[model samples]
Target: MTILDARESGLANGGPSFSLGNRLLRAVWIPVWRLGAGWTPRQLHPWRRFLLRAFGARMAPGSDVRASAKVWYPANLEMHEGAIIGPGVNVYSMGKITVGRKALVSQGVHLCAGTHDFDTPLFQLEAKPITIGAHAWIAAEAFLGPGARIGEGAVVGARAVAFGELEPWTVYSGNPARAIRQRRRFADDASNS
Candidate 1:
């Protein structure tokens, strides 16, 4: 994933952060998504998926995104099979956000893939990618900052704020998420099934 510096990319000097084409796509997408899928019933996953795909989201079959969830740029999203973006989740995909197979992003979670470069004089926007590995679970209300990488089978507890890399098969919680415990290996836990 490329980290974009808005200033260096010629978007500084009071110019819009995104190109006209990007703005135009979003302009058409917002209302289309709202009218076509945002108010649909929860059971209409296929319908929602179709609209998302039409807008350039890479949604694998069986992936589900709730009606109340807000995806900033569908073109920057990629969800593998069985990945679920729950109700009220905010996918601020100013950059790429890849949700691996079977990952679950619970309700109210905020996946922010962009932030301002505070040290820069222009305070220019910086876009970095976020990745949630296969079988990971990001609990309700969690905030994942730009460049966060949640490993496979990891659990980010409710309301946690995560940044950078989280080890696989671990449980993390709190504001600056820390490993609270090592998660039991899913392969060894047949009881869940």
Candidate 2:
């Protein structure tokens, strides 16, 4: 294909990572997400979880996604039991995003699993999977980029930006995220396992 054709192809999908059906699904879901589900009390969490599942998210019953949080495509998201996505979080799941059991994604955190191929003039969309392991905690306002993996029991500090795999049982902080210290193991850890 010609260079012009390649460029046109990138934009042809209307900036969506998925198919027309997915776009239509989100179109329908947006209203419900912002109005109906978003306004519901925390006591009505089951109802909200139903909506996410109906749209294809593989989430366990105990997981909680706050009212203000936004998940781009439910089909590309998965969260295990006890996972919590706090208020104002944005999960740009252009690809797969998995949160393990008891993982906590704090308020205003951004899990962006999509980017662009800057090398190409067309700036084609590139999607990668993000995985947060069991008991990991992504602190408020952190940004986890495509292909980032927060290992089991890891803790990410506020406003940190992570673009790669973080070690297990570690504490990370700052932009680009550095390992600050080892995460302390809980007394109940053995009991849970």
Point to the candidate with the largest lDDT: 1
- Clashing residue pairs in candidate 1 are none
What is the C-alpha local distance difference test score of candidate 2?
A: 0.84
Estimate, for each residue in 47-134, the C-alpha lDDT of model 1 and write its tens digit: 9999999989999999999999999999999999889999999999999999988899999999999998888786678888999988
Give the runs in model 2 whose Cα sits over 4 Å from its true position: 1-17, 187-193
**lDDT at position 13, candidate 2:** 50
How many steric clashes between backbone atoms does each model show?
A: 0, 0
- lDDT score of model 1? 0.89
Query: Which candidate number would show the highest TM-score if scored against the true structure?
Result: 1
TM-score for each candidate, following the candidate numbering: 0.93, 0.88
Write model 2 residue lDDT over 58-159, tens digit each, in one string: 989799888889999888889988898899999998878999888999999999988877886657677788999888899999999998988888999999
Q: What is the Cα-based lDDT of residue 60 in candidate 1?
A: 92
